[model samples]
Structures are given as structure tokens and as C-alpha cells.
Target: MQSDQLIVFAVLAATLGLFVWNRWRYDIVALGALLVVTLAGIVPPEQAFMGLGHPAVITVAAVLVLSRGLLNSGVVDSLARHLTKVGDKPWVQVLTLTAIVALCSGFMNNVGALALFMPVAVWMSRQSGRSPSYLLMPLAFGSLLGGTLTLIGTPPNIIIAGYRREVGEAPFRMFEFLPVGLAITAAGVLLITVLWRLIPRRENQGSDQELFEISAYLTELKVPAQSKYTRRTLHELIAAGGDEAEVMVIALVREGHYQAMPSIYEVLRDEDVLLVEADSDSLKRFLDVTHLELAAEADSKAEAREKAEQEKQAEKNGDTLAQPDANESKTDRHKERALAEAIVTPGSSLIGTTATGLSLRERYGMNVLAVARQGQRLRQRLGKIRFAAGDILLLQAREDQLPSTLSNLGCLPLASRGLRITAPRQVLLASSIFAVALALIAVGVMPAAIALVGAALAMILVGLVPTGDIYKSIDMSIIVLIAAMLPIGEALETTGGSRLIADALLEIGQSAPPAATVAILMAGVMLLSNVVNNAAAAVLAAPVAISLSRGMEASADPLLMAVAIGASCAFLTPIGHQSNTLVMAPGGYRFGDYWRLGLPLSALVVLVAVPVILWVWPL
Candidate 1:
């Protein structure tokens, strides 16, 4: 390679090395690379940030918005209710949920699929009395595997399809990847189910209590009953009963026994009793509400529930695994609330703060029902446990609070999971519009970019996706990275860096057979995917694959397939794929944790993919 090319190569290498080192934000790394190239005169100044406007960037943003709209409709949560009922057996639960999540990801966004299922998975972990750590990692990995199977499942696939078009060919058909992708998916899901067990168990594993430990129900209350405590004001109520039984008056019941929420000033009335949820020991000797009202409600249902438990113990004979699904006799529990999947940002103040201290309930009017920290189940004493960065917090709040609360918490909501199918009225319309756009692009009626832009405009005009949130849905970091890096890739090519890299591989494989060249291409692309972004890796490696194939005078399919397989196998590191990073905070995963599971998965992909690629598309 010439000196100028070497300079570009050196710049690209340093940029990627720093990015993997993660000393600075990845977007900054990409920008720095482009600036270095421009200052070095490898590329003109006009080309900097050009990739920001690329079609891939725009489409990714639009898709994210559309996914958010889907979440806002409450479709994903409803799916959880039905799914949790399949079976409570560990493998059975994993199989069913994994399949469900994968199917969800295949059609929708994979990240969304994982987000939607996260709560449900946590619930399952609680009901099963297992550590969530065992389940969540598999869930994350499964979602990643599923998304790779479909064109819309992941962005890299979309970018590859777009690149295929730019190379003077039609974009990939909707299911073009099924042949290789499905096989990879099958292998991946199986690996997770079986091999995931091989991962070392962490400290304090296996707690069923985490899921059931929803927000503490402690609230202030004026004692009332059918005259439980007459003539007591709200101020007097807390003082009288709070010592023996901890109760704060959150609200009041008023005249004619109306259960309207009360203000602080109201006096307790005759026959009115305060409602409270407290620890049983503290409530054992309480002087609050009339014993009759409190006792009656508990004995009727409580006795019956206790009797049912006894009967269940006798019938099952200590076999808890076969017990009914937690929601087998479910009621209408879901309400008009905003549910979101937010990752605790690395430097967030919310880490280590519980729901009470953060005033999530009092301030934001939301509840932090569950905190997914790495593989731990944190369902109990939530107010007391310190949160950490990288935990995926499952929050519930009024629809309006989501925006501000998220901003305050320094959390990034997963774009894909909260898809509410609430707008069933627009289901056909929204889906049809998306499908039409996809079809138009796939069939070459318009550039994928034009079709997506048109669809986004149409979606806005029709009120499918709201006009306000359209921009927020797109991941600007990714768009910026792609935009900044595309020119860098171009510079790499222009400066002959890519060619030198390609020649070195070809020369390295000179003594080996042509099949080995394909493996080298696959390995090289996989490394590229691991260090840079996956789509960027695919774009960088494709021409290299083609060039090496031409040099060896062989069919390019095997080599190209190698590049494709390697690019999408973003297993070894979080930076390789957004979905991987998306789960990091929620899973409480350290930057180094992914490679522990992913390194093997990536190797599996290369090994399985190489033989398959060679067999299916002979060299």
C-alpha cells in the first residue's frame, strides 16, 4: 500500500482501537477519524459527516419511531399475559418465551421484542423462584439471534441490502436471508438454552422474591370504617396508628362513604377506616382500623386462599414447578399507563437509589416495579436497594410522565419493546403503510431511502406515528456513527487501505486452499464487526471479499457469504451491535461480560457458518 493509504489505514486502526478501548464516546471516535483523514488530505473537507444524511440513517430513525408507536398501543404487554401461561418449567419457559421473543423480533424490531418480554421474564423468574440472571442473559441473546433472521430484524441487514442495491443490483427480498439466517438462529437459540448453563453462576443467585417485590404500598391514611375511628382528622390519624402500625395517609374517604382520594386536611369520619399495607408482624397488634372490616376482608379471601394453598400442597405434593402460571386466572390488570424499557446511563444518579428515595412515586407519579440488574431479580425492598448503571429498569407511569422522568433519570428507553398495539384501528393502516414502503423499496420502485421518507411523511400526515416524537425515535448516535464512518470507509478504499488489508489476507492464505481464504475473510469481517459497527464491517468487508474471490478466480458467493456472516455475528462485543449494548444497562453487564458468552457464540457462528457457506455456495 502507498504511504497515503497507509496513513488512512493507520487513522482507521487508531480510531477503532480507541473505540474498543471505549476511552471516549463511539460517535466521537468516528468523527475524530474523519477529521484526521480530512486534515491529512486523504479526503476533501466536503465529505465529512456525509453519512449522516445517508438513507440508512434516516430509515433507522423512522423505523425506531414506528416501533415506538407500536409500543404506545399496549400490544406487547398484552402478549406477555398470554405467553406466561404456557408452562412454568424452566426449559419449557425458556423454549416458549424464546420462540415468542424471536418471532416478535423477526417481524418487529428485536430490541423492542426483548423490552416487551423483559417484564414478563422477570415475572416468570419470580414465580419460578429462580435467579433472573439465569434467564435475562438468554433472553438478550435470544432476541439478538432472532433479529438476525429477518431483513427488518436488524439494521446491518438493511444496510447490506441497501449496499447490494448501490452495487447495481436489486435489494434483498424480504426473506432472502432465511436460508442462512434461520439456520444461524436455530443454532443460536439452542446454544443459549443448553450452553448458557455453562456460564458461571454469580453471587447471590436464585431468588423468586424479586419479581413480587413491587413498590411498597406504605401510604398515609385517616382511619375510618363503618365508624372504625370517628372524629379523627388526617393529622391525628397518622400520629395514632403510625407507631404500632406504619400507615401514612395517602388519601381520604369522605361523606356517604365515598372513596374519593382525600387531601391532607380532611378529618376522619365515623365508620370510616384507613386502608394500609404493612408488615404482618407490625400489624399483629394494631389499633388502627376496626378489626371487623380489616379482618372480614382478609378472612373471607385469605382463608379461602390459605385453604387453596393447603389443597395445592396436598395435590402437587411439593412439586412447585408444575404449579399453575402466575396469571392463569388473570383479571384485567393492565391499565392505561406508559410502560418503558430504560437503561440506567453509566453515570446516572438514579443508580443505587430506590423508588422511594428517588420519589418515583411521589415526584414522577410513576412506579419502579422492577429493576433488572445484570442477572439479579430485584423485586423486594426496591426503595432500599441501590441501583447501578446498566440496569434495565421496568417503570410504570402515567403516559405523560414518561418523557420528563426518562430525561431526569438519564435513561435510554429501548426503541422496540414498548410497541403498543393500542391503535388497533390503525393496525392495518400502519402495517400496510410500512409494508408498502418496504415492498416498494424491495421491488425497486423507489430507492429504499425515498420509500421510507415518503412513508414517514405519510405516517405523520395520517397520525399513525405522532409528529412530535418522530425525531426522538431514531438513535442519533448510530446515525452519527454511520454518517461519520461511511466517509472513513470511503477514505479507506480511496487510500487503498482496504485493498492492502485484503491483499495481506490473500497473501496470508496463499499456501492454504481457496476454502481457507473464505474462512480468513469471515474471520476478518467478524473482527471488523467486533471493533467497529456491524454494518460498517459489512460495508468494509464486502469489497474485500469480492476482491479476494476475484484474485483466486473462484465464485464470489462463498466469500460474500463469509462477509455477511461475519458482519452480523456481532457476538464478541457490545459495540459490535446496538442490541447488545441495549441490554447492557438492563442486564447490569460490564463491558467485559459480553465476550464471556459472546466469544464462544461468535466462534460458533464462524465454524458453523463457514462449513455451511462453503457447502451452500461452493468456492
Candidate 2:
């Protein structure tokens, strides 16, 4: 082994270990690896950042923005609304939902597609009175299947195309993947639809109350005349509870007027009713410290009736509920407060941060009323709980700011029923722009990245995607991961490391038929993807696949296609892909639950993909 190969191999091993350790973020790990290799002189410092300009990275970012545009246009939402009419059968619902999400995944970011449809799937589960577990896993698997359909569908396809270009061939055409991808997707979706029973039917699948049981922790307390905190600001009152207090004051009612998510700066008055969320210990401590008492059941019932009568009278007068006083400005009437449930998205910055650390209430003006993970409410101190991807938060915020807040926080608001359609003109314009870009790519008139970027820009210009949201729509962590990992992949090939690894793989399959070698290669990459990010798996495996092809005296196209298909087969674990992770909490899936369906689907992909790849891009 040459010195450079040894160095590259060491760095690669450490990088993979870090990825599997799942401690640091993948992007940070990749970036650190890139810097290490560059400093070691394995890759020239001058060319270290060149991967940032790679077309694959550009296409992924553009696709994300375009997906947001499609979402904002409400075109997909309109289509998803009709899913309720798809009927009550489990198989029919699974088939229809998976197929649509898969089709959408082919054109846009697969994770984005999955996020958009999750709420709809949950709503469907609720309406049909079934476990969401049956629908969510299939939905996630479908998104992965869909990504195989286009060059821009997933980062791996674009990365594979870039590798093809390096091998002196035209990059894979936009729909060139459709032939093999369509077949694999068809097989996978059918298996999921027919073998839906493979997914575990976990309890509390569709009901938020069952999942979080918020009522168990929510207690209404009152500030009496002698309470020391009565005249202080809400912030001061909460501060009085000391650092160990886990309670949150979610709402305040003063003389029959309700304030949802009242500001912490609001002053507490005598006789005020506070709706608080806290565990038993925290509630007792908070009450002890603040000298506040739990509202009597009689007072609570009377207050409920009084509030209901006020709402009834307001409705009779054609006024909005929670009407502001005459002295209040019109802006107060339009404040539109709401309490909603949101799930933390994969790659969210909030994953490791605590509410106190982020100053969520002070900064985002939202109160974290309660949180649930994997179908059970968390009983620990709320302020100290570190957020994790797929954790469900019960948030109270202004209705208008909720969307952007969730977007900024990298969370997805759970669907609350019904579809909201944007203007017809925006819908037509967004669809037309996307169609034109696809047409351009199909005819070879423009490159995939350029055409898609142009389409994204057009959407921004036309207000289909808000200017404020363009950057937010792009998942920068993914972009950085791809950019940073690209040069490392090249270094593996350039340093002869890939060839060295390829030689060993070739020896293992020397006696096996070439078709078996393809299966082995695809299956190996598939397993790697199940642990690491799929794009990183493709990057590391692409060079090895290319080298393996040369040693076998075969064309590189079939091998590269295998790498592409294998990279997207990140089933068998929630951590394998963002789509899977995003559905875990909502579906009440355990860590081991994935493989029950994933194992079979993975096998099906290998069985269907190898023959199709051989027939389409023969060795």
C-alpha cells in the first residue's frame, strides 16, 4: 500500500466510524474529513473546496427550493385533499398514498415529498380508525423508491451522473433512470401494499391525546389576592420557580378573557387563571414557590361555561372568537393565536438544543406546551429536554408566525384537517414552470442543474416561493455534506485507495458469476447507506464500483447504476434516511420496526434491480 493510500484509508475509516457513531452531524464530520485530507496533502489545498461548485450539489439545492415552490402553490395539497375519498380499505389507502408520494419524490426532494404527505397520512389514519404505523413506513419507503426515477430525484443519481460524465459519457439523462427505477418502485410499492401487515400496529397511532396525554399534565392554577407573584410579570413568576421547575404557563385567563400563549412580559393579576403544563413534582414545587393554588373544580367549570357563552354570543353576532376590546387595534383582532403539534424535522438545528438554551419563548415567541417521543409523553423537565428529530412538540404561537417558525426551526406542523389552496394563477404558473424545466432537461436543451435552478429562480420571481423562504427551503447541511464529501471521494480514487479496495472485492467474487458480483456490490452499498448518509455512501462506493467494473472487463454503466440504485435503498433503519426518521415518532415506530418491512422491500429491490440494470445497462 502506498503512503497516500494508507492516509486516505485511515481518514476514510475514521470518517465512517464517526458517521456510524452518530455523535456529530454528518456534514460537520464530512467537512472535518475534507480539511484533514487537504492538510495531509492527499488533496491539494487549492482544489479542496471545488466540490461546492459541483453540479450535483447545485441540483439538490434547486430541487429543494422547487419542492417548496410546489408546496406553496398548493397544487400537491389540492391533490392530497382528495385522498379521503380513496375509501376505507387499508391496502387501497396504502397503495394510493405511496404511489402519489413516490411520483412526487421523483421530481422533487424525496424527504420534502415525504414531509408534505405525512400529515395527510396521519389524517387518513384518523379517519379510517387504523394505526398510522401501517401507512407511514410504506409512505417513507415509497419516497425512497421515487427518488430513483430521475437524475435530480435524489443526490445519489446526480452524483452517479457526474461520475458518468467523468468516465467520458453524457451524463445520465433526466428520465434515463425511469426504466430501472420504475420497475423497482413498482415492485417495492406492491410489496408494501400487499404485505402491509409486516408493519407493526402500534397503539396511539392517530390520536394526539393518546400519544401525548397532555391532559394528564395540564393543570389550571390561580393567582389569589395574597399571592406574592400576583403583581409581577409572568416572566418573574416563572423565574420564581427556580431552575428546576419544569412548568410552562401556556395560557392566561383574566375576568373571562383568554389569552393563548400570553407574552412572558404580561403582568399577573389577582384572580387570574393560568393554564400550566407540569409534571407532579414540578407542579408541586411551582405551586409552593409561587404561593399559587390549583383552580377549584367549580371555578374551572364556571369559567368553561362563561368562555363558551362568550364564544356563542360572538358567533351569533358574526364576530371572531376571543374578540379584542374596543380600545384594541385591528392588528390585535387579526393576531389569530393557535396551539398546534409539530414534529422536529431531520437536520433541524434544534436537535441538540434545549428550550432554555434556545430561549424559544423569548426568541421565537412560542411556548413548548408539551413534547412526545415514540408515542409517549416526556416526563422530564421540559426546559432542559434536548430536542431530537421526530420529537413531537405541542406549540402555542401566533397563527401567522406558526408556519415560518416551524420552517425556521426545521419542524413540520402536523396536518389539522382540510387543504388550503393558493390562487389558481400561482398554481398554474408553478406547474408550468416546473414542466418547462423538465421539458428542457428531457430534450437535452439545458443541463439538469441549470434548468432546475432557472425554474427555482422563476418561482421566486413570481412569488410562488417567498423570497424570505428561498434560503430556508434549502437544507444547507445536505449541501455542505455533499460538497465536503465530493473531494474526499475523488481523493479515494486518485490515491488508488478505491482500486485497492476494489481488488479485494473482486477477489471475493472471482468465482461468482458477474451477475452475482453486481448483486454483491449493490447489496454492499445498500448496507453502507443504511448506516451513513446515502450520498456519502454513493460517493465512497462510486469509485470502488468503477474500479470493480474495470477489473471484471465490463462497462462501468451497469456498475454505476447499481451504486445509484443501492445508495437510495436506505431501508432497514430509521437512521438510514431522513424520510424514515421523519415518520418514526408520528407512526409510533420503534427502532427495530423498520426492518420488518424494510428487509423484504430491500430484497425485492435487489431481485428486481439487478436483472433490470443488466438488461438496461448491460455489462
Candidate 3:
């Protein structure tokens, strides 16, 4: 090999090593490698930054935005809610989930599809009493299958289609990939539903009963006229309640006015309602002994408690305590449980969606309490500041509705998913729009790049993802990786590295039949994909396939298909795709677990994709 080619190889080796080690963010590592390549003169410095603006990179960013718009429009939200009723019927659940993810991916980016559907899968897993692992891998795999139906579905397909221009071939026609993609998707869906059951369940994942476990309760205390405790200090009440009640006067509500969290020595007064955080057990004891009825707690238990208390007080006061008017008490009870607190989780529903915009109070009958901003408490008006991925929110709901409200909004309960966003809607929407753009491209209505970029702009129109977040979703690391590796791939051709490898394969199986040649190419691309981005794998292997064809003086279509199939079949590791990285957190997975199912899935793809490619593409 030429020394320049050797240097390129060293760059790839170091990049992969660092990627595996995860010493730094993947994007930074990729850029670092690119810089090294530039300095080493492996890639022309001008072209070194070319990958950042490559059509593939631009298309991915735009597609991501479009996916966001589809979700923000509530198309994905409505679909997810419907998925729940059908999500838990075992094999039926698999079919439903697979079809949804696959169909969604066909129109959006694959990662976007998986992200959109991940919550539903998690929700399904909890509802069906199954591990999310079962559904997530299939959802991810289904997304890949779905992407193949169109040119813009996944970056690999786009990259491959785009590269066709190098051969003086028009890019793949829209729906050209559909027949093969559909066949593969159908077979893949069948395998995942049947064979995915073979994957062992993970431990430490929270089940349904544990999903919404509430660790804290925030309620309001109404200071009534003639109440003997009205003059007490915050410390006095806390001391009296002991461990039974821990009190912080979050706010004092007077004449319907609210204050941000109050101070420790804040004096109490008649007609003032105070928001306090205390255990349910202690709060109940205090209410019973002191004769202050919890008007709010009863929005559920309120009716029974208020009546019982009035009857008891009537016997003592005779006149002042006659049954408190039922309507009056109902209103009071509804108003009672007015404050609740939950820590926002990284994956929370509130991350991208806003409270005022979502009609949270009207739709879910809940109100925003004070927001807890980790080391910093929020001073901005709670309703004005947009909810972020990691900010904690204190909310108020009728005590009885807390569980359902939390679950419905896709917010993980504070005790469990503190300060993390659990909402997957943005991801889902991003995927859907991406898929649609692909459909448009596949049908030849527009160029694949234009279709994808349009979808991303659509995302901006709807607000599913923030302006800043649009850039955040691109996975610059993968972009860099692709760019940096593009030079390495160039070197492979320059030094005959790919030719050298292709020559060995042709030598071993030169006489073996066409099918064997297909297999060798398939294996080569799959191996390369495991260690690099699938697009890079396809790009590197494509020239070799063409070279091998030149050597054989035969048809190269089968070889091309081999590279395409191998590029998408990166099932053996989480590093293969962002879809896999996404599930890593929720699945509670170790890096090793992907191969348990991925290895066989990959083998199956080769076994299946090869024959189909040969039959369809011809020798």
C-alpha cells in the first residue's frame, strides 16, 4: 500500500478505537480524524470540510425537521394513543408495533421513526406486562425495513442512491427500492415477531406498577377563620408534625393571588391558603385532629370526608356546621389539590411540548406548580418559559387524577425519571416526515435531497422541535465519521486496498458460481458496516464491487445489491445506528446485548437479501 493510503488506514483505526472507547463525543472524534487527514495530506484540505455540506448531511438535517413538524401537528400523538389499545396482545402487539414503526419510517428518517414510536413501545411494554427490549429492537429493525421502501428513508439508502450519479446513472427512481424493500420488510417483520421472542428479557426495568410510582405529594392548606393554628410559624408546624409532616411554605395564596416559594419565617394568617409538601400520612393526621378538612384531597375523597366532618361538627356547633352545601364543598375540593410537584425527567413529555399550548389544564385538568431547575430554581413565570428536556416541574392535579395524568402526558413520575424528558413525539414526527419526503423522492416527484430538506423545514413550521434542537439532532459525529472515512475509503481505492481485498475474494471463489460471489460481497460490506457508518461501508465497498466486476467482465448489479443489503444489516452492535443508541438508555442494555439478536438478524438478512437481490437485480 502507498504510504498515504497507510496513513489513511491509521486514521480510520484510531477513529474507530476512539468511537468504541467513547472517550469523547462521536462528532468531535470524527472532526479530529478529519483534521488529522487534512494535516497528513490524505484528503485535500478544501474537501476536508466538504462532508459537512455534503448533500447527505443537508438532507438528514432537513428530514429531521420535517419529522418534527409531523409530530407537532399531533398526527403522531393521535396514532400513539390508538396503539395502546392494540399494543399488548402478544404476537398481535408485535404486528401492530412493527407495522406502525415501519410505516412511519417509510415517510420519515428511521431514527425519527424509532424515536416517535419508542414511547408507545414503552407504554405498550408497561401495559402488556413485557420488557421494552422485546418491542424496541423490533421497532428499530422495523424502522430499517421501512426506510428501504424509499430513497430518503435512511441516510445509507440516500447515500447509495446519491452515489449512483458517479456511474453516470440517474439516481434510483422513487419506489424502485419498494418491491425489494417491501419483500425484505415483510420477511423482516415476520422474523422479528417470531424470532424476537428469543431475546432474553432484561432486569431492573420498571414494570407497570412501578412506572408511575410517586415519591412526593404537594397539597394546599387552607387557613380558616377561627382556626387556632393560623398564628403558628412554619417551624412550629414542622416540629409538631415531627417526621409525620415536613413543611415548606411554597407559596401563600391570598385573594386568589400566588407567591413564588415563600420564606421559612413567613407568618400564617386567616383566609390564607398555603402550599406545603408533606407525606400523605402526616397531612391526613393533622387535618383530622385539627378539624381543618382537606378540601383538595377530596376532589376524590373530599365528599365523604367533608360530610363526615360536618356531621361531627354539627353535633358540636349545632347550627354553624349544618351540611356544608354540596356544590360549595365540591368546588372547594376541586380547588383543594391545586399544587403538585414532579421532577422533570430527561425523556419527559414536557421537554418539547409546552404546558399552555398543550391545554394541559383543560385536557388533563392539571396546573403548573413551581418548576425546580436543579441547582437553580426558576424565577420566570412558570407558564411562560418553555419546558426543557432536563428541567424539573412541580405540578398540581386533583389527587385522584395524578397517576392517569402523568401517564397520559408521557411524563415519567418524579421519583423515577427525575429531570429527564420521556417524550418521544419529536423523534416520531421527525421520522414520519422524513419517510414522506422519501416517498416523494421514490415517486420521482422531486430530487431526494430536495424532498428531505423540505420535510425538515416542515418541522420548523409546526414547532415539534426547537430551532436550536434541529441542529442538535444531526449526530455531527456520524457526519464527521462519514466525511473522515470518505477519505479513508478514497485511499482504499488509491492504494488498491479495496482491490486487494476484492482480489482475494475473487481468487477464493472465482470459479464458485455467481451466488458465492454475492455472499462474499455481502459478508465484506456487513463486516465493514459493523465498524463504520453503513453509508461509508456502502461507499467503500461499491468501488470494490465495480472493480471485481471489471475483473470478471460480468454483470455488477448483484454486487451492488450485496453492498446495499450489507450496509443496512448492521444488527450486531449498537454502534451501527442512532436507533440502537436511543434504545440503549431505555432498554437498560449492555453493549453486548445487541449481538444476541442482531447477529442472527444479520445472518438472516444476508441469507434472504442475497437471493432476492440476485433474482431481482440479475447477474
Q: Point to the candidate with the largest lDDT.
A: 2
When summed lDDT is taken over every stretch of 10 residues in candidate 1, the lowest stretch is: 328-337
TM-score of each: 0.70, 0.91, 0.68
Cα lDDT of model 3 by residue, 5-111, tens digit: 67766776787787667556556776787788789876777777776676766766666566656655556656766776873567888878988888778767676
Tens digit of per-residue lDDT, candidate 1, span 1-619: 3878778778867876887786676777877888888898877888776777777777666666667655544555566768768767777777667777876676566666776787677667667776555566677677767766756666676666655543455666566666677787788777777666654444343463432243354322323345534554554554555455543322233432333224434666654534444455545445434332453353356558876887888777855434445442111122223456567754356866766677665566565656676645654444566876567666665555575567566675643233243556566567777778878866667765677678777777787667666765565666777787777767776666666677888889989987777777777778878777776676667666656666777766667667777777777666666566655544445667777778777777776777777777687
**Model 3 off-target regions past 4 Å?**
216-440, 443-446, 454-480
Candidate 2 local lDDT, 1-619, one digit each (tens): 3888989999999999999889999999999999999999988998999999999999999999999999899878877878878998999999999999999899888987887888888888877888888899999999999999998889999999989876778999899999999999999999999999989998776543356566687787888877778778999998889977778887787886778778889988888988888888888989888888778754656668988999889889998775436335223422444778889987777898998899999999998888888877887778878999899998888777888888889898875524675688878888999999999999999999899999999999988888999899889999999999999999999988989888998899989888999999999999999999999999999999888888888899999999999999999999989999999998999999999999999999999999999998989
Q: Which of the predicted structures, 1 or 3, would earn the higher TM-score when compared with the native?
A: 1
Which ten contiguous residues of candidate 2 have the minimum total lDDT?
326-335
- Whole-model Cα lDDT of every candidate shown, in order: 0.63, 0.88, 0.65
Scored by TM-score, the top model is 2
